[model samples]
Target: MRKNEDNKNIAVIYWSNSENTEIMAEKISNGIDETGQKADLYNVSQFPIERIEDYDKVALGCPSMDGEALEKNTFEPFFEEIESKLKGKKVALFGSYGWGNGEWMRDWEDRIGHTGARLFDEGLMIKEFPDDAGRHACVEFGKAFASF
Candidate 1:
C-alpha cells in the first residue's frame, strides 16, 4: 500500500452514541496517521460539512440502529444532506452492528452507489463492540483506504 499521501485530503467523520463506533474511528484514524498522512477527524456534530468539497476522500462511521438501519437521528440526516454533494469523491463506510446479519451495511452501501461517489471496496462492519482483532481490522481498513 502507498505510505505517502503528501497531497491528498482525507476526512473521517462519524457519529457514535454508544462509543463502540467511536473506538473504531479512532483506530482507523490512527492507521492513516501512521502512514505519514493526516486525516481530518470529526464527530458528526463538529464536522464542517459545508467544506465537503475540500476533501477528495472521506471515511464515514455510524452504528446500526432502529432495526438494521443507519442511525436515524443525527447520522442519517447528515448523510442525506451530504449525499448529493459526494459525487466524484472516494468514500468508505464503517459501522458497528448488534444484530440482523449486517443487512444495514449492505443497504447503506447500495445507497452510496447511487450517490456517484466511488464506494471503496465493501463497507466495514463490526459486530457489537470491537475486540483486539477487530481493532486491527479497522486499522488495516484504514491503511487500505489510505492506499485506495
Candidate 2:
C-alpha cells in the first residue's frame, strides 16, 4: 500500500443529475486528501479527459438510469475515451441507483477490469441518495484507491 508521503495524484470524475453522486465524489476526494494526496474532483460533463493521464489514480461515479446502467450522455462517452488509457492504473467506482440489483455496477466493474486497471474496492451503490454510511464508504474507497 502507498503511504501518505507518496503524494500520489488522484482524480474523481462523476455525473449526477440529482446531486447524489456528486456528494459521493466529494467524500471520495476528501478521503484522498486525508492520505496526503492531491485530488481533483470534477463533474463528468465539465471534466477534461485529456488531463486524465496526469493522474496516478482515478475514481469515477455515475448514477444508474433507465434500469441498471450508467447515464448515457456524459459518463459513457467520457469513460469510453479514457478506457484505453487506464491500463495498469488504480481505479475505483461508485454510484447511486433507484432500483434493481447492482447490475450496473457489476457490469461496469467488469468493463473497467477489461482495461486492466486494478479495482480498489467492490464499488459502492446507493439506493436513491447516499446517507452517512454511503458517503463514508465513498471516502474509504478513495483512500484505498490512492493507497494503491
- Candidate with the greatest TM-score versus the true structure: 1
TM-scores vs. true structure, each candidate: 0.95, 0.91
lDDT of each: 0.89, 0.85
- 12-120, model 1: which lDDT tens digit per residue? 8999979899999999988888778888888998887797888888999999999999889899999999999999999999999888888888999999999999999
Task: Identify the runs in model 1 with alpha carbons over 4 angstroms from their true place.
Answer: 1-4
lDDT score, candidate 2, position 68: 88
| lDDT over C-alpha atoms for residue 41 of model 2 | 87
lDDT of 2: 0.85
State, as a TM-score between 0 and 1, how close model 1 is to the true structure: 0.95
